[model samples]
Target: MARGEELYITVPSMFRCPISLDVMKSPVSLSTGVTYDRSSIQQWLDSGHDTCPATNQPLLSKDYVPNLTLHRLINTWSHSSAASSSMHPLPPEITSGEIRQLVSGISRRPDAAGVDELEKIVRFASYCEENRRFIANLHDSIEVILRILIRDNERVEFLESAVRLLDLILLENGVRERIQRLIFKSDHEKCFDSFLSILKNGKLSSKVQSTRILELIASTNDSRQRTIGEKIEATLPVLVHLMRTETDKHLMEAILSCLISLSTSRSIKVQLVHLKLVPILSRILSDPETASPTAERAIKTLHLLSTVAEGRTAIAEDSGCAVAVLDKLMKVQRKAKEEGVALLWSMCCGHGDARVRERVGKENGVTKMLVVMQSEGDDRIVRRMCGDLVKVLRGIAMAESSSSYGQGGLGSLETKTTHIKPY
Candidate 1:
């Protein structure tokens, strides 16, 4: 067997860490008689949990001892298993020297040569987890790449390559925080402007990469999310434009995810409404073949948009938008159903527009599905909202019944006394 090459064997249950669920490299036993990977348990303890994760028993002592016997058993078993099989040698790890060479190459040559360097970095990072960790931890690795992006903001090919590399490596530990710190602390405007430039001018793949990066950054925390929303406010129009013009499912999904993350801000929500996001999302949702995740995101964006007056008006004003929202109620996914309920509630109740309520009431099986959703699921808010929606639909039914009676010259008493069941 090659030196230091791990055997790709199925781990025994006892060999797995309870916290991370991975094969433990350094097993330790706690006071509760539960064994865990030392790093996992230490991290859990560092995060301020005083109880054992597996048993939830109060930890009388925070200290742990190395599971020397268990560790020896695992190591012996691994070696024995390796001896019985023809083991394939793992790929060579990418080195900091190689990354430094690429960074220097990109700096010295910023044309096809630079793009070639970035392609190399991207290929290396994309190879495996070890390579990604190596590149991500190497000092100034991400910063150098971001600098290439900023310096060559006008070079489309280089920009695409750099953005692609960033997207690939940003998932590594501390890479996102490193980039976040670099962007916000130094060259904030230039970094974001480069992203904006990509959104506005780069090709479809590059735009997708940029949008994915935005989505990742937005997911870090609320403050950073709001900051990104404000910084990329200009790109909101660009994103909406892309959604309107592009038909690629991946690009569409990425843009929708970024928008949904940024839509938490009221100003951003209003800007999106003004940019006609409602109709765009409505059109996406109206399609039958739209992927479930995409449809759910579209519904969620619309649900957020419905929180504001302008958004509600925009959705209610669109002829097919309200129908699209109702369509999601019948979907099998609970999230879609939840967003659909919240959206319909926001429009019907927030606007108090009788026309919107009447339209929801008129849709087939909506009430039945809403009732089913309430009874089957444990989401109390949805149940309560469903109850309110049912009342509105019933009221709409009664109003229509009363109108029909009056038109037929039936007695006023019948019109006044009639009751309509939603089911």
Candidate 2:
């Protein structure tokens, strides 16, 4: 008999994952192949934890020798049962004693864990990633976990790690939106007392609590389809509040990312600009004395302002969206540079109506384009766009010059101030 065989066995019975109380399958191996999960099991065996579950005897991860004998017995027993069941009439219900024994057997397995409690937990996490409906409402699980962590017990330190793991669980469809609404009261005013209390006193880390706030206010459920106007109307207040008071970049980043979703609709774009968010943003980006890392992020938010066609037209009408962008263009590279060039191109090329060109000319837009064109931003696209702007400027200049040099040669002062009406 093996010396340490007793230690290898489950104290009272068999074992299982709290999740998927069934025997674990496709045990994932980590990079070291030591830990197990679905994705990396084979790698785990390759890294080598060879030992039989029964006797602690040397066994490969793939085929621990003990299971072979167990498998043969199960196959023979199953074959005999099948033959008997096929040939005989069905039996009556089992006696109470037999039922109790069956129930007892299932309960005793370490894997059973009093029922599939751990299995279901693990399974739901699996469902989130698979987009399967494992749980009736998985976001509820996130909330439950948060509230548990908020009590500031042993799990407080693990709150962030739990969230990251939940993110890996990816609830698709409008699950994101559903959960957001679920967390809040139907009447926003009604729930403020409770939510604010948590905000003020919860022991969950700031990042975690802040994450919940952003999730409720700004994050989209995978299944939602809100126009920018809808999102602005729905979340603008919460976002505005956070923008005023929250400084954590990640929480701010989540809010900003949600705001980016609003940049798609012209109605939403005009409304936000009209609300005066632009000036606040501009101050953030160009505050030389108060420059911060987020200044670079504020620079990137230029994309949101420039993306809307109507918004660009509004900029031409003096929204300051363009000026804000041109300011950022001074410090562009990688993605920031890419967005600047694209926004500039949109401002110049995507606009309709000659009034935009007239406005551009009036705003010293020629000088701005000329400077960008002269600098390293001289990508062929920028140069061509600048060339176009200059043509507009030159055309305006030429028209003035021609009026000054009227048909009467040098022209009289009164006649030189001529008006040429369009036909």
Candidate 3:
């Protein structure tokens, strides 16, 4: 493992927090005799839960007794010859005053040195998970980055660092809620327009970071859908453009992830279908080279889109959609399997035509359904749904066969499936 500038042999298991599964920097003992990181335990308790998250037992006291000895041991291990070579020690824990000073420095002069300090602060906070937790709710730091973004003569270097830092701050729930309100609560649509503009015209790194923040804002847990709806409408076209034009695998995954989150809402799903995203997603899913997260999010997005009538018809009319989904069944991750099957079921459900059924049978759709049912027995819903799909496919095949026999020729079943355009 690598720590900051040092190469380490290994991290001991005892140094890990049971709740977060991350290395504990500030070990603390709980009343239940289990030791945990102070922040992790404090957050767990702060959420109004009395039982331990790692062990469901109720706590006798909600106090976090600091384990000073273990803390010292971790400090020694961190500073010891785990460093293959001598390097600068880890930066001290950043204070609120120091952060304020850094922000002030940048505000005074948005030059190279100011940007350097900004990037340096961001880099230090990323050194360990604890640092990220510490900086997660830094509203002042976020405001400084925002100032950098809106400043005249915006430096690409500064913009990138500022956006990266903003992304890190939004990881905390309280920061997300506050930022959401600050941007969207006052009916200031231009603030959102800036995000779309950056996404369309910013540098590569800035574009990625812009998309990340836009995704967080769109996915905020607000009861008011009007703001989210507006954001989606403004951003959908740019998201489609990015998905098609981006060649970087990781960037594409992030874009698709945003799509998945946005498409979960019924209103946004309609806009996506109208924009004709079905075929693009289907082609991506069929490609063997697509990364797993991208494929999973694509398939899930398609599943949500299929819930609407336009979505189902769009998916079915495309020649590759059903075949693409079937190709991935029982071949990808578990959730992908479920999504693929669900989409196929939606496509074939109301299509009572002979040609569509025969096409499905010829495409090996029925055979794939059977294989998925067998492989996914542990999931009762998948098993039941796959069985129902096979039944429907067989019924279509039987009707097609009977019609062919009545015409007294096996060649009668060779009719091509017609694609009907949805109104």
Candidate 4:
């Protein structure tokens, strides 16, 4: 249409992907079901601009991220180059057969018990960012070193170096998960005690490094493998200390969830109550937005706490604990009905106190819980538990109804009505 139109060169089909050049790797799926290299194609599709480049037809299905080794290779190379400028780089890959090489390569002379070997081992652990085969080996190496550091007979000074190295290892996000998964069957207290010492260092910056420590400590799977006594005796104080000192949400979640899981311990239950964590938990329940998904983790932790005898005693001591957990049940009714229904169902644990029932019922918690209970027509467990919760609620309502009758029957009946009429 314009004088310059003929000057525009046509793009060649060879430039397109030979497999499907119309769109360059929308998902880039491999035969192994791994999808890779998204953005360029995904954004093109998301922009509502999909059409076959060669045929001019609408785009079809898109693919998911794939599990191909080449994809991992590409991602690894890209991140490695980018991470060169950082203090810590790529995280270690979880590998199976490299444990022996990792162990031997990092071993010190039998007499090298000084902090010098500790320093070299720590540095090797941190280089996991480079993520070569060495990266995997380094992770395995950390386990062996951790054993040496956590051994009760080891000099405490080298244990201190393990703390610093642990922080560097967690600089990568997935490292926390890897550590959480790996620390399951180890002498965790030694590691935790080491971390606590680092935390207590007066010279350490409380802002950034504290949060990383909290995350790893929180996600560590110590509970999954350790005895309940071991978990409380070894881990709770350290995590409690983290909760008391750290303010970042990720860290708070890790500490809180860990604490919640450990609430079975009479000691930690006493400590949380002694520290007045109930009001804090209550405030979080009232406003899940402070932590978003972390808030959800907190709520689940609270639910777990509610199941323990020590937890119950703690709740009894702090009225706010029951109030907070039930408050979520109330919120589920008014603001998030779907989630609320689930809470009520779970909370119908065959029993609750009068004060809790009253507070929750006054907050309109009963109506939602009743609806869920009424719908479980054939669930015997639900039926038994719901009946108990309903009894509690009805008793509260009857007590109110009788008091109202004493005050003024008809008018009170109108005001306290619980029935809903359908239009």
Candidate 5:
């Protein structure tokens, strides 16, 4: 044994149990629902106590359920911190044979027992990074997990665990592409269809993970995007609804990233336009408190959507759109600002009548364009856009001025137009 001087001098409060006043290596929950260090709780029960030590309530039983999630969190914290690492031993390694045996057992049972075995394997994998890497390398691993996932009659816990496991495996480099190719080669439309079903009907956690997996699959290439777009009739609306309703930032960001990818296709852009995604994007952009990266994606997606007629109409219809685009002129990141400007130009330059141009001018768009042009140290493209926008706005102003003259002072209007070049 080591000397007393080598023992831990202090433990983190969150890592300690109230009963033992020491770091908990194996935390467990008692019948009263109070958690304590397993050893201390067991010792108290072994003394024939009839009440919970923490709650002072009558015990339902002496049994305890392992807090696997909390245990994983503790293990992660212990591995990552220098102070904790000195006092704790890391989890043991899980070998390839063990993983294969677990998979085979799950495949054979397919009952509650199989689910317990699968959950055990998942817990073991979640305990350490090495276990995940080992599982990722196993041949036919994705196939086995997908097989279990596609079973309609399985328990929800089993499906959730299967999705979580699949996500973990896909996070490994090159694994996503392999799975993509595997699904493409096989008759696996049902595999992809299962994702839409989950997104529509699964619990919140499962829906979020399923969306992540769909985004990963959608990002592979144009062909895959088209494939998914054609198969799922309600995919676009579902994503837009989630973006509008989901409050989680990461989930919203994931949905936006997938939207950006899907909107890249002109064919699909029309479908997205029909879904009226521009108003949704405009809402996100106009809110000053929106996250910077999320706003960037919103405007970029708007830029793509603006390539079509319906998209331009939707944007112009939103009263805050011009201001939203103008708000990002110099306020957001460079890419976002560039996209915002492009979207604004698209709204004005292409088939935008005098009424549209006047609406832009009414929003102080001309002054904003001049500010962007005069600001130093910007990309040449942005400066060029500023100049073009100023010219267009001034031309519209001149045309509106001439038209308002109503042929009563055509000569006077011609003289004023000649002097209007500077703005």
Candidate 6:
């Protein structure tokens, strides 16, 4: 056992539970003569197993007797203060019976009782990582919690406690894999629906958890990504609403990440633009207080949005949005610069908006920024994009100048040549 910086003690292997692999607080002996933690052996027995877990031998009797000798030794050894000045205090021990009782209560009762059980589970799990692992390892724990989320979703208090508990236990790999499996199953439609409901109506923390859970599922693989993308019509609006109403930076970041992951299909992209995702993202980028990481994600999502015609058109039509994209050219992050260049290139060149090109060139001074970025030795691709943007802007300038001269608006039409080296 190790606690803090001042204490270290190697717990004897015999004092650990074979099933949980944690220190045994209550040791018991099965019929096969192997001593185990009372809670671990009791859980095994309650699960309807008749054989010894360690030896897999037929049990002469299913009942286990307490091994008082081992318990006493563990108690004495654990209380020794001579080994170190200070040891990390252990959290209050929770028995397997208590876990089973709570889980059973949650499954059988779907009222205030269920909510109370969930709160108890959350409190116990929150006490320490060991308790979390213990509860997560118990069969049907995560399933029961998910069922509560799906069944009692209309109950705000129940949903809040259940979602909070789910978030806490989601740190376990087994729990996450189980959630992924449930999400992929065809019959589990209500499971995903429950998350959407939470996003729309639950408290802010619950909404954040639901968004993060969806983000995790969406990021797993192509199949999961496609599954989530299919729900874009239902999911996108709620996310946009949250982004518009919520000021919490963390939640905003989560929503942005979820957006980036789910914006995979062309139809989805079109819907995102229609849902005003472009302007929401634009507003995020326009804020001076947005963190660097959040800014990068917002830019990346906008870049994705810019892939479609509607997205590009919206961006080009909003001059503040256009200026924001241009401003990214001066950011210190290489990725921001790269994505910013690509986004602008798409809006100006891909969209073929002469006004945007002129505005970016004449008003935003993108020409000077691009020139400096190139001169400072950016990567080859960024330099190439910079070159392309410069050429496009210069072409637009010449076209406008020639148009003015042909209309007889200017006093003199003088041609000047300036050379820029190719990237």
TM-score of each: 0.68, 0.41, 0.65, 0.53, 0.68, 0.68
The residue ranges of model 6 lying beyond 4 angstroms of the native Cα positions read: 1-97, 104-113, 222-232, 371-378, 395-422
Model 5 per-residue lDDT tens digits across residues 237-294: 7877777777665566667777765666676788887877878788887888876656
lDDT of 6 by residue, 29-88 (tens): 998999997655764564335667677676879888888898778777766773223332
3 against 5, candidate with superior TM-score: 5
Per-residue alpha-carbon lDDT of model 2 for 252-330, expressed as tens digits? 5445554555455566666666665656665555445423224444545556776665556555665454555556665
Clashing pairs in 6: none
Show pairs that collide, candidate 1: none
Q: Provide the overall lDDT of each model, using Cα atoms, as 2-decimal numbers.
A: 0.71, 0.43, 0.66, 0.47, 0.67, 0.70
Cα RMSD, model 2: 19.1
TM-score of candidate 1 to 2 decimals: 0.68
**What lDDT does candidate 1 reach at residue 194?**
78
* Regions more than 4 Å wrong, model 5: 1-96, 104-113, 224-228, 353-356, 374-378, 395-423
What lDDT does model 2 reach?
Answer: 0.43
- Candidate 2 TM-score, true structure as reference: 0.41
Question: Which lDDT tens digits does candidate 3 get at residues 198-236?
Answer: 677777766766776776666766465465576567899
TM-score of 6: 0.68
What ranges in model 1 sit over 4 Å off? 1-96, 104-113, 220-230, 398-423
Tens digits of lDDT, candidate 4, 139-166? 4545554555455555445656655565
Once superposed on the true structure, which residue ranges of model 3 sit more than 4 Å away at CA?
1-97, 104-117, 123-131, 137-139, 147-157, 187-191, 203-205, 351-356, 378-380, 395-423
Please give the RMSD to the true structure for each candidate, in Å.
Answer: 10.3, 19.1, 9.7, 13.1, 16.2, 15.9
Q: How accurate is candidate 6 locally (lDDT)?
A: 0.70
For lDDT, the strongest prediction is: 1
Any residue pairs clashing in model 3, and if so which? none
Q: Is candidate 2 or candidate 3 better by TM-score?
A: 3
